[model samples]
Target: MTKQEKIDSFDPNGPASGNRIFGLPFSQKDAEIVILPVPWEVTVSYDAGTALGPEAILEASKQVDLYDPFVKDAWKMGIYMAKLDPKVIEKNRKYRDKAVAYLSAVEVGHEDETTDELLAKINKSCKKMVNWVQERTTELMNEGKRVILLGGDHSTPLGYLEALAKEHEFGILQIDAHADLRNAYEGFTYSHASIMFNALKIDNVKKLVQVGIRDYCEEEVEVIEASEGRVKTYFDRDLKHQQYAGATWKQQVDDIISQLPQKVYVSFDIDGLDPKLCPHTGTPVAGGFESEEVMYLFERLSESGKTIIGMDLNEVAPGPHDEWDANVGARLLYRMANLFGKNAGVVG
Candidate 1:
């Protein structure tokens, strides 16, 4: 059926019937937005389930209600996820075991030749994944599709950033609990913890504005200090302190957006949210924003007149029995996707 015909027959309030995202009926060609699901997670330092995130989120997305009060008729902004790459999946499963063994060895100071070999192999594959993402996204961009990357882990977006840097000089608005700035963290160049550090190497990326950073090491702080205003940090503690001093979130959000350039890329890690909302994420922190608070940030961002060049939502891991994490991820993705439409003047 054509997109209009599908729209005519579908019920927004009924049980989800198809495998399509949010039960929307548009195919990739019919939709204005495309979601690239990266299904590889090799260097997760704490948890192992995030490699399964794209499929989990895809399953959960079917159950989400399509109505949005903020972005009316946003369901018409079609979301089509590309087929998950099997090569990436195979490599993830193969390397994750080695990553686990290597991490365990590091914890006990038992690094050996085997661990070194594993590190080299994993790093090489991660580099390949990055290049794959850049190439695929470059093709999608060439087709005039607005792409949002749904990730295997935080490490998935380096190539997406590389693709964007070729044509646009944009700032990053990173929402996460960790600083993600450790250089070659744990000897893995593409470790999830090192995404932002590696991102800074891209000269076209002019600024990075980070928020909700409650957990980070001194080396990350040193990186920020050495960045010479290229990095702007809004620590979770300082934001709370300001709130306690009677500053409203609206005021704080304005301050945060002020640091960004005209063009922005949103990099959202589900762990940036309170752990209760995303308990199965790779690394859960003690304090973070509620879902609505983060949504409000996105909402305000849409109203700020800044162009959203691209976005990625990462680190959503599904539990064995509980669907709460993916459920939340699905709803968040729905909201975030609509805002993408709103920013681009294509929907809402």
Candidate 2:
């Protein structure tokens, strides 16, 4: 069926059908927004299952209702995820084993050529994954589709940012629990902890506005300070203090939004939400916004009329037995994608 034919016959209230994302029957060629799932987590440094995030979110996304209150009948906009690349997954598992072994040796104060070899392999493979993501992202962008990345870790979006930087000068609105500002964290060039540090290196990325940052080291703090206002942080503690002092959430969110430029990229790490909401995430932080609070923030962002250049959601590691994390990730992904669509004028 043609796009319109499928939409005309589809029932928003029915169960998801046809195996497509959110059960929408749209192919890559037909979609206005394309989701690229990156199944790589070689530099997690802590928990490991974030490599499973994309597929887990895909499975749990079947539970998301088609209707988004923020954008009426938004499912018609043709949202789709390309098939997860098997080669990427295979490489991730291979390098992740090396990372684990290397980190274990480092923990014991054992440094050897073998450990160095493992570290070298992991870093090279990680760079390959980033390049892989960048190539695909550029291809999709050339097709006139808005790309939304579903990531294995915060590090995964660096490639997406690279692709965008070539053509657009934009600021980042980063919703993350940590600053991710470590330079070559843990000696891994593309560590998840070093994502923002890598991102700022891109000349087209003019600024970074970070929110929900409740976790960071002195190194990251120093990075932010050295940025000389290029990097703005709204710590979770400070936001809480503002509320304790009788300021409204709207007022705080407005200030956060003000830090951004007219064109923006949204990078949401699941741990940015309360740990209870993303307990299985790679590195769960203690404090975060309620689901509704963040959702409301996204709503206000769309209202602000900043052109959403791209988006990414990452760090949603699902537990072995509990689907709660993926379930939450799926719904949030849906809402966030809709917000992007609404701003891009692809969804009403």
Candidate 3:
């Protein structure tokens, strides 16, 4: 069968018939883009639904239109899905239960006899999860595959970032509502809020360009300001001011692009979108960018000659009824494909 026909037969939202070709596949050697589903949401502070995020996104991805209008023929890039780690899921469940029990006890002004033990257990689980993800991501990078992590929460990408750092000295283009610059949050060393702090310590990360930062602790703000030029924040309020001052978003986007290094790693938190799109995300803030605005920002970055080395889309939690979060995530995945297609040197 022709290649286009194979791709056309596979609807991203529809059930995949055995013969239909879904997303991009790697070449004869192996898949070009390796998708690592890290089904972990243990350290999420405010919400509990992100553990199912990866599967929900994959299920919804089945319905995405494969023909990317931007770069064209992005499906040919050979996207390969890795096996979901059920062991990770099991560990995550245990951690979450422990955390919930501990938090519940604390909230009610009661002390559980096993409080200390449970907290210790949860921290251990988070460390193990990070090591596992780091191991998997490192293996894939050694194999010359660009990794796109399907996350359980924003914390899930820390290991991937660590792995990517080993090979590429790149800047982090962080798109998120929160600063994620806390040293450790809620007594968990690997909490979602600490990802950037961990990433900042990694030697290979050259710069951090954080966008959509509307929520952060005062200390976190001080850290960003004190970092000199190493950590640049285009705070959401500043973005609004730019628009209010008659700066077109296109120009602002270009300005955003200028702060980035030639090579970038996009850490996209779904909560960076307007909360309306992802109500279930762990800590949806009061204000953020529209999905299209974020997409355009990245698209402009791609067009301005920056290479997206690796990326992670995280914090997308599915609600009980609507699939809005996954839908947004799947489309973002397509946009990632378009960016990767442009950068990976794929021909249309």
Candidate 4:
């Protein structure tokens, strides 16, 4: 059988043993790509089940067409998929259950030991998750591989972000429905709501430019205001108003890009797209970037000579029957791989 047929025979859940679209052994070095599946969704405030996102994306990736119109020969870059760590899965479940209970309660800051204990458990587990990811990312970087992290949620990239920080000072191009600037949401230090806030804490993060922000609290606004120019937000409200008044999205994209630094790390939460593509994502805001616009944004970034050091496409969930989000995510990942390949001079 051919390589594709061999991979088709390896899927444990499917009819065969190695039916993965990308094939088995999951290790590809020539492509200069390391795909880390972080099966974490514990700190997700609104919805559950993102813990199942990475595997679903992987399964759906089998159906992804290798030909990318924008970046030719992107598939030649070896795409390496790392197996999901079982300990992270166990930790994610424990924290997910704890978060559900914590969020369901009336009094949030109840000075009780149970709350404290749960908080401790979640934080400790998250630290372990972050540290392991950091170590893995650093190892990959040292091996001269570009990394694309598949997330359990937005927060899954924190460790990888730290790893990137050590090597280069880069800016963040965050695409999400929410600002994710909350210091700590519902007493969860590593909450999805605080991903950007944590990034802001990193000294190496030059600037954080967030787009598609439509959900946030008064507290989050205050924090953004305090951040000054360090965090530049392109609010959906304002962007829509601009579009309503005849300003094109391209103009808006230009405005957003003006605030970024030279080197960029794209943090693309699938929720940043219209809800139709990802109805089951952790949080679904009313307004978001259309997939086309996001693609254009990446294209523009690439054309502008800004090196995309690393990126994460997270919070993509598979629906009951549809594989739309992963379908989109797989394409995004391929596009990003091409972009990284070009930046690293791997793809000519």
Candidate that scores best on TM-score: 2
Kindly list the per-residue Cα lDDT of model 4 for residues 267-328, writing each as its tens digit.
99988888987888988878787788898888778777778899898998777778777777
Better of 2 and 4 by TM-score: 2
Ranking by TM-score: 2, 1, 3, 4
Q: Write the per-residue lDDT of candidate 3 for residues 112-156, one digit (tens) a residue.
A: 657767778888888778888889888888888878888888888
Which pairs of residues collide in model 2? none
Runs in model 4 deviating more than 4 A are 1-26, 105-111
Q: What's the TM-score of each model vs. the native?
A: 0.97, 0.98, 0.91, 0.90
Query: Which whole-number lDDT from 0 to 100 does residue 27 have in model 1?
Result: 88
lDDT of 2 by residue, 63-149 (tens): 899888779888899899989999999999888988888988999999899889888889999999999999999999999999999
Judge candidate 4 at residue 66 and give its lDDT: 62
Off by over 4 Å in 1: none
Stretches of candidate 2 off by over 4 Å are none
RMSD of each: 1.2, 0.9, 2.9, 4.0
TM-score of 2: 0.98
Better of 1 and 3 by TM-score: 1
Among the numbered candidates, top lDDT falls to: 2
Model 2: weakest 10-residue lDDT segment is 16-25
